[model samples]
Target chain A: MITLNDLTQISETEWEIPQSFRSDMRGPVRIFATRELLDHVLTDKSLEQAVNATTLPGLVGAVTVMPDMHQGYGFPIGGVAATEFPQGVISPGAIGYDINCGVRLLGSQIDFETAKPHLDILATRLNQYCPSGVGKDGMVKVSIPELDQVLRDGTKWALKNGYATKADLARTEEGGAFKGADPRKVSERAKKRGKSQIGSLGAGNHFVEVDLVQDVFDEEAASIMGLKKGHLAVQIHTGSRGLGHQVCTDYVREFQSAVRRYDIQLPDRELVCAPMDSPEGAAYLGAMRSAANFAFVNRQLLAHAARRAFEETFAGKTKNWHLHQVYDITHNMGKIEVHEIQGERIKVCVHRKGATRAFGPGAPGLPPEYQKIGQPVLVPGSMGTSSWVLVGTEDSMMRSFGSSCHGAGRMMSRSKAKKKFHGDMLRLELGDRGIHIRAGSMKGLAEEAPDAYKDVNAVVETVSQAGIARKVARLKPLAVIKG
Target chain B: MPFEEISHTADWSIRVWADDLRGLLAESAQGMWMLTGTEQAEGPRVSREISLEAYDAESLLVVFLEELLYLSEFEKIVFDGFSDLVIEGEKISGIMEGSALRSMEKEIKAVTFHNLAIHESERGLEVEIVFDV
Candidate 1:
């Protein structure tokens, strides 16, 4: 078990576990956290997993973990690692089962006061329109052929099908579609699972919250992103659903032999991987990109549903009730990019599981309007708490592989949360605080109580102080819809 | 039940033990059902045959449980009984019997191989499985 005593404090918000700390580690582990947050992380296996991640072949620099880090199956949540492109291994577990699990923010022009009277109706309508919960099919059903198109075209398919607009695509990552997506690489079982779940918010910590932009930290950046103080915004958090889960499962299982064939040894079986140049790796990359595209389209469809809900609640009453696309960013993903490491420009595949890409100003691939400010990094807080909007900094690109924390990571187990808090009572509490709640299951709601997670403000402060990301605005939840 | 839930900071984990591989597999399935709080409908019981191949016992166990999860999520079927089970070099075949799933309180995203090992214990065989939810 790793403890605080084993770490070397690099700074007030930085620590390191030297490679020599463990014989199997190929590199050091750099952690970004405050002293108090480090105490929370030491209680779990998160640091151990970070050290284990250093064993991967072709690793560049140290494995960096965010302050919100928590113990996960293989790679700890809020972890980031980069491997040499086309040569380094790509572990399915590193990218996570929910491929491209991310957050989408849509800013509205309507003020919170104008939309106040209809908040309850808006929450119900959003819940009614957006399909959520376990084993629930989406509102949009596509044929197998259409599903393949979604895998290939992503939000472009949504555009063709009237589910999205050009502006929406421009604000999404990779234009809401990743290149090199091959449907043939996806299993038939995965295709079947994805065919009916195009626009669903699956269970387990996924939600769509209606937030009010309460504070703007950077007026220029917030203005560029169309975020106005006192206005309403919507955040949709989900992923590739069952399809992505099946894809990861199939690849993780197949890679069990790939590891043996390649003669690669790992401390854990879940960390199994294959060289990016190998046939198995190529297949997984293609299939994983396809799943990611499915997720992009999934969020687009949900945004469309959310727009309808907004229109239903404030269309005739308010002149401009439209929810414009602010930004869509994926937390769980593997992207090939070039970065300078030790004064050498190297191309590497960055694997981020529960970490957000925080590209700095003037970075390529960002929309023109955002290039001056930087990419929008959405950090959604737990239910009925404050969510943050941040921007990437040049320091992020040089120090942390252009990555930052994802959310207020879980501080307590689900069972513990359920045992400590009553679902019904928690709902009432939120209601008394004027935050409307619509949940499919009270037990599920209890599992995600705000007290179960770390403080979002503290997480944002850590990342900002570490110079990986800069704060733009803070949002307060007015209503929530959980699966 | 020979399996019980264990404390995990995030996700779910369960420890199971039995006298043999077959018993271990059956009990693991039961434990998974318990973790999800799966309830069956008041209908006629259904039975189906299942066959799987893997690189090892750990992989076989994951495949077996994943098969059940797939069925439960996509087909709304839950299996609680196993019979005529056989395990060969890298394959397993058995009959699974259960009823339609009426409701499930939780969703198990995937069965992970995080430190998964089936080994001999003083009692018999034992393993701990972590699930991603």
Candidate 2:
């Protein structure tokens, strides 16, 4: 029960929970939110979890939380923590069960007006091509050895299998593949789960939407990313599926003993972790990276499916029906990087649970065209709302370790949403608003009602005012496919 | 029913109480099935054996439920009840009887150990489990 009075206001958009707030905290907790949003945050245990996160061994600087922060199982969603490189601890719960759960944006040159008449057909085609919902197998199934290749090669496997192009890989994070993924470290059960779900969008908040770029704030940055107002774009939201879940489950369970053996005490069992240099930590990292790579390939395959749908619906009618990759970014991930902390260049592992990596201009990993503009951060809004395209700032690197808010975080419980809104009613309401809706289950749709989430506009405003990220474009949903 | 859904800001939570550990686990499973809106196909009854061991009761509970989840996802089966149940020390062995799942409304990602603890109440045993959906 941390209240607003317990925090020290740093500025209009910044607040701090001093390390003195708790005896065990290794560092302070820095929060980015407006006064209004902070009131919503106070109703949950998000701040308490942030304080608990500060107790992790080898923590550096302050634990940072974005405006979209909400109560999660272990680490509060929208929280970020950087720990001293090899000596710090990595908690599986901090990075979340959905390893590399992220968003992919593909911009097209076709005008929305030209494609308006076929939106219904496009939704059906996309739903048919992209496998979604619970217990659903993907479009492609692979043998164990083939799955191993996918674990190691990621989007490179997609390229080799004719599912992706060279340009698409360039626009993805870490080239849509992470190094040091050893399949041997992953469990056989995890492998089996990965085999059949290579390209699936599992239910519970995962979706693919057709959006129209309604406005562009940064003309230069938007042009570099191929985003033009009045044109159509597609956003794919999913992750590594059961493979990632089992990997996290296996590690979280195993680390319960590792924490005890290493003499590390935590306030929460879900936050169990091990030293990055220890055998247990190394093994989990290997397995986690493999699951992350599987996710990258998963998104690539979905993008391929999306492209097929686009071509089928728009081809012959429009001159350019192909969807070009804008950017793909993962929110739930831990990456090893070097940062300047307290005037010292220190290597650290940054854990971003429900935060996006928003690398600013001149960052090392950006494609050549994006060097001057910065990395594209796609923030998809709740169903039938406006999504945002933002870019990282140098202030983000300096203040928040190059991270930004993920989305309009959940403000209400799923059960509450279900009780207040009927799925069929919601669909009809959205349809009245001109947004075509296709979902696996109506009840599932009700659980994700728009009112269940915080306002995305306010979230974007908070981060923008905090100087971590800047707006590039705004997108309005035309059609939504939910699992 | 000995179990009911609890309000969680982000994910599903359920509170269950039973006369003992075995009943608690069974009720938890039933609660989970209800949360997912799982339906069974019409067919002959099927029975499968489940045996698992863990370091403690909480761990055993998680392991047991996760086994059911794995079976439901991969083997496409859902258990309705358990028989010949035995809980000795850290090991539990039982027979699960159910039918093939006709359909499931949603997906439960994993069983979380967030503040998971089985407590001893005057009635018997009670516990709260949070699930990542």
Candidate 3:
């Protein structure tokens, strides 16, 4: 087994395992972390996994691991890579099981000071309105064709069903739909899994929380996002659910053979991939995009459900509680983006696992209002901690493929956390802090306790220090809804 | 051996290993099939080429198994194992042959890292992997 002594420190924040260290590696593996974070990463095979990601076919740049990197199935969580378009392989493992597992932030009209009185009631209503937990079904029942449309159209389908509006779509990432998603590429089983999960939140680390925009770092950027100090917002984190999981599982195998057929060599099986131009690769992309679209619809419908919850909670209030979409970004996804690699503009399939797309201001893909401040990067912390609102930087576009850290990466395992903390104690602790939590299961709550994860402040500081992303605001949780 | 009545979730995982890269890969596939309850369908084998590359050995295992799942879903292939395991760096190239996946076939939806472990133990080499089916 490789030991910690094998690594050579490049910078205070970067660690490198050179290509000479392993003959199977196509390129070098670079990790961004402090010495303390590196100690935790070394406890598992995460560093080894990052090295394995370097073996992907036609990898153009060095494999990168973000500060929040953790051990995952194939590639380490928070890993990023770019492969040659059409020639580089796309492994489902690289994108992860949850296809578009992402975060969405909504800026509300009311301030936290005004909403504080109803915080407890709103948390309960949100948990009740949004279906969650294992084997949960969406509030909307869909037929086969309608479900296919949902898979194909994403948030646009929500607009058709009167679940969303044009403004909502405009505020979403990629306008709430990714192009080139063909539902025909999706399987029957995948379809079935997605049918009932369109507007539902699946269990295991998924959450919807009420947050207060506690601080703002950039007045101009914050103004564009309609953010003010003490204002309330909603952050929802989830993904494509079983449909995306099945899609990834189905494609990793297809590319396994394709990699051999193409005669490429690598160090890890989990990093298996086929050339992007190959039939197998194209099929996986099509299916992945479909899954991504499904996730977009899933989140949109969930927002619709959240709106309904508010409507029910305050039926005869002064004004309807509308949660306007601020931004939506998928952490686990591969997007075809053009970036300057060594001063040449090249198209690359940027695979971000447990990372967010932090396209800088004036980037082509962002919405009109956000063009000047860059894409709003929603980084949700562990329950009862502070999250962040970051904007992409030109430095990110030039240096790290317009990517930034996702959240307060896990430091402790679920079992370890469960053994150390009790659900009752955690509930009381959060309650003592005036943070109301409505969780489906107390056992689940204990697993996601704040201590189970690293500090969000440190994680954000790393990215800001790296200059890939700039902090815009810090959001503190008032209430949390865990599935 | 082909699996039978195997049921594993992303939450509950197992890791198996062998000396050669191919042997390790075949056993991993075998373990996964067993977890998915696919042992009951002892059908004719179909030859298919499977290849993958990772920066390390563990990630290679993950990609290899994911490929097995993909082939089973699309091509109806339920591979028992790989024969010629040749691994260099993170890339593992091998020949896999398995039965086709039918309606009655057990399917493993996804691979997870809930309780995953990989190491060289008394039983040659062993790995602990989780499946989310």
Candidate 4:
């Protein structure tokens, strides 16, 4: 029932719903969107949900919604909230059901000219070599015991199994492992569900795309990320799969009671949470970390799959197919991070659902190679559009708690998009533009039509102009595999 | 009754409501099962007993529904309806029967708390839930 009038425009890109709007609100709600995009926000209950998020207990700052914000159960997607450490409550809704759903970018030395003739074969090989579609299984099935180790060790397990290289780990966020993961906290059922689906590319919006670096804005940053104009790159968007979903599902109900026990008053029931120090919170955190770890390992496995596909297509010709990991980042997650809050450094659990971590230069978490520059921000565009590669900026730390927008952001609903556009027509249109499309379902395909999303180029322009992330390179899709 | 779709931006969700606590729970299970197209699920029948504790009526409702989702996806049991339900000191204990865990004909994936509510109204105990797809 909340209306757009409840929000005050802070800037062209920033909107705010102050704490006085509701009695239960502990903070304000901040949204990032253009006037055109606000229409989508107004069409649903997403803006209201964003306002409700301001009521979460121990919320330190405004409940921030990224430009890609949309209605989600509990917290809106592209939402970010930093609650005071041990005292603040951790809500699964804030972290999202797709725990650690994220993207990883691999830059290559080869250019489109070198890869163009073999593009068809390479696309077909990728489709064959990589197991995709819904409920698909891979060749590498681990035993129950081995799976448990993976839950605990994440990408380390993949590295140990020869599925990932040291360089892959070096370029990944947190080196592809969240140290707090405890497999014991993950339920037996979650374990079994994850066993068969470790390397799978599950259905619905998940994709593997081969792209060409179409433009480069910052020469130094582009060089650091190993991007050169016209070079080929790969992007994989997925997550912890069944394990993460189960973990979030398990905790949402758990935190419901925990919220009541603690007498936490929330404007929305979906924002149910408990103090981070409590047993329930600890349990959820442990389980969430395990799932995040699973996602990291899952991507590592998929990367290995991509590598094999390239090798099979090229035939011992890796010199031109030198795919190096640019960066891997999680968009939906809750991490215990130390940040300067009102001049004092305090540890806090930052829940970022559908938002990316844009750590500035000199951040401790960055790898040695990136410390001098900043974290590599991977922003995947809509299918057949331009995706971006950017580096975090110092201003991001002061402005957005070292976070930025995740994607181009949806401007239309699936049903509306399907009604407006035909999947067959879209495939033809994209094909004419030189982008290849392979999918499990055209119905699902129409749901993600590029026309349904905002121009990613514009989104990148906002973040770059706003000084949150410095644009490095822009990538145009060559081929896409969706499930 | 059929499972109903609810609005969720980043994910998908659904809801089911009933009068009594037992019926409310049964309908929630039914809604989730229907969402997953359980009638279409190809698997053998399996049975399991569930016990859950909560501090309040609303949380109890959530826990009850979550247990059903967990059982369906994990244990592969599609419990029809529980025979008995007893509420004591914020705890609800019941027995459910269903089918073996197998590939889901449709992936309901996860249940979410979006717009979740449990209350005693003119219709008795009214409950609503959202599922994350």
Candidate 5:
């Protein structure tokens, strides 16, 4: 286990665990957190997991973790690692089970004050319109062949099916589709699990929230993205569902032998990997991209559902009720990109698990409207708390591989949270504060209580102070829908 | 031996123990179901056979639990109990029986191999499994 004393503090918001600490590590681990947040991280194995991540062969630069870091299986949540392309290894565990699991923000012209009267019904409609909960099916079912198209085309399928708009695609990461996603590389079992899950929200921390843009810090940037203070916006937090989970499971299982075949040594079995140039690596990349594409459509369909809910609640009453795409970002993903590492520019596969890509201004692939600002980073807080909108900085591009914090990292266990807070009481508490809540399972609600997570404000502060991300706006929840 | 839910910062974890490797695997499966607050529906009992091969005991444990997880995910069926579990040289076969999952309070996303190791203790065999929920 790693302790704070072993870390060399670079700044109030940054710390480092040198490669010398572990002889097997190929690189050092850079952490973005204040002493207060680092104290919380030390209580768990988040730092140790980050150190384990450093051992990935061909690791370029330092393995950086966001302030929301929390122990999660092999690689800690909010961790980011970049490995040399086509040579370094890609570990499925490093990318996470929920491939392309991410957040989507939709800005609206409807002001919250004017929409307050319709809040309760909007929450109910969102829950009803968006299929959710365990064993829930999507709004539309596709045949196996059609599911392949969904995987191959991603948001293109959504656009063709009339579920998305051109602007939605333009504003999405990679334009809402990952190229080279060959469905043949995906497993039949993963396909079966994904076929029925498209457009559906599976349980466990996934939710749809209605928020009021409470404050805008960077007005020029916020205005360009169509975000205005006091206006209502929607946040959808979900991922590729069972298909992605199965893909990771299948690869993790298969890679067990691949590690032996490659003669690689690992501290944990979950981090099993193969050289990116190997057949196994090529297959996983193809299949992982397929899963990622599926997740893009998953969120797009949910966004379509949210739009419907918005229309039903505000159309007849207000003329300015339509919602526009702000941005969509995938937090749990591995993408091949070129970044500067110690004054050297080279290509690397950046693995971001519970970390969002926060590309700074002038970065390639961003929509024209955002070229002057930066890629919008959506950070959702625990239910009934504040969420944030941040943008990547040039410093982030240099120091953190263009990644930032994902959310309020969990500080307590679900079992402990459940034992400490009652779901029914939580509902009343949020209700007393004027936030409407609709949840499939009350027991599950207790497990995600606000107290279970660290202070999101503190997390945002650390990233902002560290020059990794800059705050644009803060949002307060008015209603939430959870599976 | 027995199984118990343990504290994991962000996900579900269970520490399972038994008299042997096979018992440990069975208990881990049961313990996972318990953690999800899963309830089986009243229906004709369903039985399924599972056969898996891995490189070691740890991999075997992951595959066994993953098979069960896949069933629950793909078919909405939870194999509450296992019988005739035989483990031999990284090859395990067993019979799982349960009813349709009526409802599940929480859904476990995936079974992870993080720090997963099956160990022999003076009392018996033990393992700690972390789950991505």
Candidate 6:
């Protein structure tokens, strides 16, 4: 176990566990957290896992941990690592089982105060339109051939089917589609799961939240993103559902032998990986990108369902009831990006698990309107707390590979949370605060109680203080729908 | 009880042990059922054949549980017990009996191989497994 004393304090908001701390490590571990926030993670094994991540072959620079870091299966959640492209390995576990699990924010012109009286009905409509809960089938069950198109075209299929708009795709990450997606590389079982779960939200901490833009810190940036203060916005948080999980499962199991064949030694079996150029690695990359594209379409379909609910509730109430796309960002993914490493421009595979990419201003591939402002980073807090909208900074590119914290990391176990809080009581309590709660199961709700996580405000403060991301707006949740 | 839920900050995990590999697999499956709040219906008793192979005991354990999870997800069936169990080298063949799932409280993403190891203990075999939720 690592102690606080082992870390060298770099600043009030930064700390470092040098490479010399471990014998087999190829790089150091840099952590962004205030001393007070550091104490929360010290109670868990997140730091140890981050240290283990430093041992991955072809690791360059350092492994970075955000303020919301928590212990996950292999690589610590809220961790980021980059490896030399085509030479370094890609671990399925590092990208997470959910594949492209991410968040989508839609800015609306509906004023919260003007719509408060009908918020309850809005919550009900959202719950009905967005299919959520354990093992729930999606709204549309595509045939096998059509499912392959989903894997191949992503949001393009949605656009052709009238489930998406051109502007929506323009604001999404990678235009809501990934290149080189080969459905042939995906397993039949995964395809089966994908056909049934394309537009549904799986349970366990996933939610569709309605938030109020209570405060705006950067007026110009917020305006460009169409986030006006005192207006309403909807946030959809989910992923590829069962399909992505199966794809990762198949590859992680196959890589167990790939490691031995390539003479790669890893501390944990979950971190099993293969060189990007190897046959196994190429197969995984193809399958993973296919799953990733499926995830993009999954979110696009849900966004369609959300818009239906919105139109039902506020179409006639407001002059313009439609919601505009602000941004869509994936937290768990492996992207090939070029950055300045050791003063040399190098292409690398940046793996972010429970971390969001926050590209700074003028970064290539950014939309025209956002090129001067920077990429929008959506950080949703637990129910009964405030969510933050931040933008990437130039310093983020140099310090943490242009990544930021994802959310207020869990600090308590689910079983313990259920034992400590009553789900029905928590719902009633939040309802009393003007926040409506719609949940499938009360027991599941207990596991996501507000007290079960760290303070998200503190998390954003750390990243901002560390110069990795800058705050743009603060959102307060008015209605939360959980599965 | 041969299994118990362990404290994990971000995922579901359990520490399971029994006298042998077969016992360990059975106990782990039962433990997983408990973690997901999976309850079996009292309508009927059905049986299904199970066969698997892996490189080692730990991988075998993950593969076996994954088989059960896949069945529950696709076939809407949950196993209650294993009979005619056989473990030869890295292969395990058996017959599992159970009824359809009555209810499930959680969605377990996958059975993971995170630091997985089946080792010896005072009673016999012991291992810890983590599930992504």
Q: Write the per-residue lDDT of candidate 5 for residues A294-325, one digit (tens) a residue.
A: 99999999999999999989998888888899
Question: Candidate 1: which stretches are off by over 4 Å?
Answer: none
Q: Where does candidate 1 chain B have its weakest 10-residue lDDT segment? A: B81-90
Q: Could you tell me the lDDT of residue B12 within candidate 1?
A: 95
By DockQ: ranked, best first: 6, 1, 5, 2, 4, 3
| TM match of model 2 to true structure | 0.99
Candidate 3 off by > 4 Å: A1-10, A314-320, B1-109, B112-127
Q: Write candidate 6's Cα lDDT for A191-215 as tens digits.
A: 9988888899889888899999999
DockQ list for all candidates: 0.89, 0.87, 0.10, 0.39, 0.88, 0.90
The alpha-carbon lDDT assigned to residue A256 of candidate 3 equals 57
- Model 1 lDDT, residue B21, Cα: 89
Give a tens-digit lDDT track for model 1, residues A80-186: 99999989999999999999999999999999889999999999999999999988899997999999999998899999999999999999999999999998999
lDDT of 2 by residue, A1-483 (tens): 999889999999999999999999999999999999999999988999999999899999999999999999989999999999899999999999999999999999999889999999999999999999988898897999999999988899999999999999999999999998888889999999989888988888999999999999999999999999999999999999999999999998999889989999889888889999999989988999999999999999999999999999999999999999999999999999888898999999999999999999999899999889889998989898999999999999999999999999998999999989999999999999999999999999999888999999999999999999999999999999988
lDDT of 3 by residue, B1-133 (tens): 4222222211335556666555766787777765454543556778877567763565677677876765665566677756555677778766766776643222344765433446676656566666643
Off by over 4 Å in 4: A1-4, A316-318, A418-425, B1-3, B15-106, B118-127
Error of 5 at A54 (Å): 0.6
Using DockQ as the measure, the top candidate is 6
Fraction of the true interface contacts (Cα pairs closer than 8 Å across chains) found in each model? 0.85, 0.83, 0.11, 0.46, 0.97, 0.86
TM-scores of the models, in the given order? 0.99, 0.99, 0.82, 0.90, 0.98, 0.99
Query: What interface-residue Cα RMSD does candidate 2 give after superposition?
Result: 0.7
After superposition, candidate 5 runs with Cα above 4 Å error: none
Q: How accurate is candidate 1 locally (lDDT)?
A: 0.94
The lDDT values for all models are 0.94, 0.93, 0.78, 0.79, 0.93, 0.92
Model 2 agreement with the true structure over B38-98: per-residue lDDT tens digits: 9989998888887899878998889989999999998889987775678998788978798
Q: Judge candidate 3 at residue A449 and give its lDDT.
A: 85
Model 1 achieves a DockQ score of 0.89
